[model samples]
Target: MAELRRENQKTTSELKETQKRLRQLTQTIRELEEENSILRAQALKLKEDTANRDLSFSRELQQMKEQLQEKSCHVSLSSYTHATVPTPTLSPAAKPPTPPDPGNSPIPQPSPTSPTLTPRDSPSDTHSLPAAQPLNTEPNPDRPAKPEAQVVLLMDSNGKYLDTKRLFPGLITRAKRCQNRGQAMELLRQDTLGNPQHIVVHTGTNDLHTLHRETAEAMTKMAKRASREFPDSRVVISTLLPRTDTPPHVIHEINMEISRSCAALPNIHLAHHTNIGTWDLHDGLHLNKVGVRAFAKTLKDVTLDRNPNSLAHTAAPPRNYRPPRYQQERQSNTASHLPAAPRPPAACYTLPSCPTQPQKTPPPSPMDDLRLCDEQSHPSPTH
Candidate 1:
């Protein structure tokens, strides 16, 4: 019993020692946790401080930008004022006046040598007033290059849908008679844009053969890059041609998504080239002769109609417009019957209202007369 009690006592003591050690371990763990929390708090504080500093720097940068803009605006305003002040005087001075004979025709004769246009003016604006006009306040992202001159086509092997350059003079084409879609896109991206007016992209037929997952993204990137890089150019993205490898439904969904993405981008035109007769199995991926002609004509017509440089730019005037002959005759008779006042320039004169009519002053309004009498009595004091 004594031996058993001693063994129990020893065991109890050992248990107490373990308990004490456990208590110490618990304290150590608590200290470690507290230290970790302190470290975390310090890290959080450091992050907040860094963020605050970054925010302050951004704010300062924004303020500087605003100030720079204001300064630039003021400078531009001053330059514009200085530039405009002497234009009227300079123009008349430059044109050495040789008074025409009194009996000479009023039709102006062109000088022998063509005059050089001002650096700021385009050939289209040669007839504009010689006086310096205020520059466009808004930035012109694209130069005023002629649409035909700037239009370019990037086509894959299947681009045989059209020979657009042939129909539209000065339009550029980079594709050979045949090329791969992936390679064409890479080449197109790598090629210098060189201030084009329009970029017509026809790719992705081969993407159907390749089953590339990145096709949509690649196409989207191409459109976006073209838009960003050539702000002045019109971007035209054509739908993929039918391929046996890819299901029609799959092609359609992909095309619809791509069209949506392209449509969302500014200055992008989504064109459909789903002509049934275009594709062939023997030719691998090429348009038939008939398809080629039809597609070409359609593209030519669409692009020409959209082109700013085309003669068809302005719609034909209404065919129904007829002269108001009876009314004009009556007015002429009435005018002849009455004493003639004065005739204004034909260009300035409009029908129904004569610009030469003297605006006769009213006999007198009592209020106006009173105001005039007061003004005469108390003229503004001048320094």
Candidate 2:
């Protein structure tokens, strides 16, 4: 019994030691969890700080770009003003010129061999009386007026749909046709886009057959560059038109990416052609007449700052359109297979509204007619 008691005491003491160790381990775990929570909070704070920094950087960059553009515009205007101003000059003639008389006076024309003289050519001419009219500010009737609204359309062959004559008066349209995104970029680089109100870039439909992600990136990059170049103008980017050869989801993804990029810029807008379906394309690639109408309308709206909803209304198919030939054939076959409805009974024709069918009767015989005549002539035995 003593031995048993000693063993029991030893076991109990070991159990108490394990319980103490477990408590220590639990405490350690709690401390580690607390540390992890602190680290997570610090990481979150770091992320927020980084985001704020990026936003600040972007704003600063935009401001710098605006300042640079303003400076450039000011410089160009100054240069233009200097170029248009007429410099003062002196002539030898002091008396006012008399009206020409065709009968006696012959106008003396300046000789082409003689060098034209200016104010700087001879200091002696500076003392002579200035011309009656030093400067004529009257507007020249022959000079072509500057366009009031300049819209730059950088697109593919789809640009042919927009007719320059039908557009608003004094609104000049400078359309550049590009075969692909690369060509579009190249054209943009080469073409000089003046201070236009809107810059429309419609591309990427041709590039969808390539890697979609890469195509999307290229599209976004092109839009960004255009926005950067024309900071004052509204940069309009058109979504890819639906093509039969490419899956709808691929085009959707590309558009989604482009939309996100456009949303990030303040001056960039999206001309959505998502309403255009496969039926709109003529050759599964280019837009047909209907599609071109809708496409042109969308571009016109964007260029003129009109409502975007017009595209959906204009792109809708006609209500009275006939179905495809295959569809018509299928429908005809199905109808042929359907059982015919039962015919109405003769009683249905009894109604006054219903037309009655004619009844047929046998013709009268000649022998019967002769017997009747003999009976009438005899008149004898009138019973």
Candidate 3:
């Protein structure tokens, strides 16, 4: 009974020890959760601070950029002002004029901010400044520019030259008043014709009234000569604008000749007469503003296209329109290039005009006729 009582007391003490250990473990878990919550709060606060710092830094950078732009603008304005100020071109004998008294003069005394330009400067020098440009001197970064096309245009008075501006940019005009295909042909014979990328021959309308076919042939010849003169330049021939003097059939025939002649020429382009519509006319030949517009539009289409290899040139037809002198010279040149042929012997020819001189033929006269009659009357005495 004594041993059983001791065993019960030992079991009671062991249960009390286990209960104390369980309470201590619960208190340690509660402390760990409080520490975890505090760490999470600190991490969120750090992220917010980083975001705020980035925003403030970005604002400061933008402000700095604005300030730099303002400074650059001011510098450019000052430089432009200095460049435009007239530099006095004074002669050795010229003296500076005396300044007026500030108190006596009605005009206010000049401020000392900037030096005044002198009146002694010549008008030419003042007008022709070194670098006079607008105040905003900085070139635009976004502007994509191209060099202007430099072209020389030769046209007759009937040509509406202003209409060409719509298509031909940077055009230099050489318009002749009261000119025909013949006159335009004469201009091509000049020795020094400048080399241009585009050479426009807008003529033949004046001569199309009576010489429509001939004028068309002459125009083709003109295109050939222009090509020869400016070997590097492409000759663009604009067709005769709408005119009442020539029938549509004549116009069609002329256009056909132009196409045929210009086909072989690699540089020649024919601007066909298109129905860009018609304009009113008094003499049935002169092209008014509307007719000119139509012609210019046709020209625009021709120039935009670079290929002109389809047009074939007729060797014999184009030659007909060439000047007589040119034809003779060409013949001589061709003959010179040929193989030398044997000449006829001097002894073989008997005529006076031959290589060997001979007797001259007598001239017939009325005196010879009277002598013949006398001989007949005296024939009986002689017998």
Candidate 4:
């Protein structure tokens, strides 16, 4: 009976231990489930943040594109006006009217015996004139007159022999055909009589296939001569437009040479439409409608901006005008009698001026010098 009781006690202990282990495992599983829920919530929040950032960036890009379009539209409007308007034409009949003479006798003059009309017995009375009469209807000279500026000649070489009358219509007053450079030069020389203030050189399309180094050189020389003859005139050198059917590389090479040549000249300006690649070359060389419009707009802007007469009307300083700092300093010094601070000494030694030193004559050399000296000392044949 005592042995049976001890076995029952041992079995009861084993049952209690198994039940404690099961409770501990249940608590661990519950903690693990809470952590998993927190991780899922964080993952969902991160995805939402990423999506919001992308949306905001897309909206900003769209806004920038809209602004660019608006600016381009505004520029197009101004460009259209400039291209369509023709330059003012002057007539020979627009001469200034002569002024009426004030001494004409239309009304009766006062009697010489009258107190107001009587001349004083003085030296000033010797040159006195009769009383003025009402003048007849005549033109007045004091009226404000329009000041005449110079006329500029703009030529567009559309790569053809078409007459200027056909190409430009009413824009050009006089147009002449010239087959070669010599003929062109002759025409230019004659145009000087009209005193052209600007010359636009548009050439090289016809000579593209036949172009050589000499062609560019000749063109450059002609431009330089034009500048010299018409010192007041501005010469513009435009790059050749690309041809649609021809290879782009050939056109590119020609343009490159043109650009290089233009850069060497001071008075010549390079007008390039393809620098920014705004328009596409549809036919390879000739511009489409859009390209032509863009080209004309660029020309108008550059012409107006650089024209001396245009700047005069606006009362704006010339674009290239910049006063030297030394001039400013000189003016200030003159006004205030304040001298500028002396510059610091240079780091290297400088050679001193030896103006007073008599240039020494070196002893005669073994060859020419000695022979020439000996010949000078001893008389030789006169011949």
Question: Highest lDDT: which candidate?
Answer: 2
Tens digits of per-residue lDDT for model 2, 141-189: 6657666447777878777776765754566777778878988787554
Residue 164 alpha-carbon offset, candidate 2, angstroms: 2.5
Ranking by lDDT: 2, 3, 1, 4
Quote model 3's TM-score. Answer: 0.40
TM-score of 1: 0.37
The window of 10 residues in a row where model 1 has the poorest summed lDDT is: 308-317
Name model 3 segments beyond 4 Å from true: 1-88, 91-149, 163-166, 170-178, 209-212, 276-283, 306-383
Candidate 4 error regions (>4 Å): 1-183, 190-193, 212-214, 275-285, 306-383
Rank by TM-score (best first): 2, 3, 1, 4
Looking at model 4, the pairs that clash are 242-284, 242-285, 243-284, 243-285, 244-283, 244-284, 244-285
Model 4 score (lDDT):
0.56
lDDT of 1 at 145: 43
lDDT of 3 by residue, 1-383 (tens): 99998898888888788888888888888998899899899988998999999999999999999999999998877566444333545556655567678889998766999677676754645543345444444555555664333465667765645545556755654434437777666766434234557767777777776674697678788888877776766678887665544455676778788888878887888787555323334345665565565556656668667543423421122222333343457679989999778888987886666476787989868999999898888875543
Candidate 4 C-alpha lDDT tens digits along 1-383: 78888888888888788788878888888888888899888989988999999999899989999999998887676455333323444356654346455578576566777656334655554443334445323334554554322334334444333333433343433433444455456556634435544455555555556654455665666667666666665666556665533444666676776667667666677666553131244434455555555455445445444442323232232355443444456677797876767776774456776689788998667898878889899988787
Q: How do all models score by TM-score? A: 0.37, 0.44, 0.40, 0.33
In terms of lDDT, the poorest run of 10 residues in model 3 is: 313-322
Checking candidate 1 for backbone clashes, the offending pairs are: 150-197
